[model samples]
Target: MERNAVEERVAQHYAGGIYAPDRAPEDMAIQSDTLFMFLMGEAGQREDMEAWMVRMAEAMDRIQELMDVLEARAEEKEESGAA
Candidate 1:
């Protein structure tokens, strides 16, 4: 699938609230991957594959952002000798 189409789907999914905020990023990634694999095994279409890829990418981005925030906080704490 084209990158634009994948991006559009990602935006739509985000706007549609397809992702649950309370779920952990790791769980989202795992569930997305598993669903994609299952769909592929069942002969999924290009759109299905693209949507799953977009979901996984978004989840990974969120995970990375969380890690960056955690790392920054850790650095701050270390510098201040708080923990």
Candidate 2:
């Protein structure tokens, strides 16, 4: 949700190499959204929310990084006239 939080999550995801580039953004979005709802629905307190938020945030970041990588690969291929 927060920009810096999301950015951190994305950075972690990149470091972990969890998702493929083409699917990262969407996956991150879905994961983050799901986590948020889980917390809200459970009426989790600040600490609980914060904890889940951190984990989800990292996942969210990973997805974005993955997407970036995918996009870069695509561009590289296009430039090399390979696709």
Lowest lDDT sum, 10 consecutive residues, model 1, at 37-46
Q: Extract clashing residue pairs from model 1.
A: none
Q: Model-by-model lDDT, in order?
A: 0.53, 0.53
Model 1 residue 34 lDDT score: 61
User: What does candidate 1 score on TM?
Assistant: 0.45
TM-score of 2: 0.42
lDDT of 2 at 37: 38
Candidate 2: misplaced stretches above 4 Å?
Answer: 1-47
User: Which digits, one per residue and each the tens of the lDDT, describe model 1 over residues 3-81?
Assistant: 3343334434553534323344356563676643343333233356556676567768988999999999999999999
Per-model TM-score versus the true fold: 0.45, 0.42
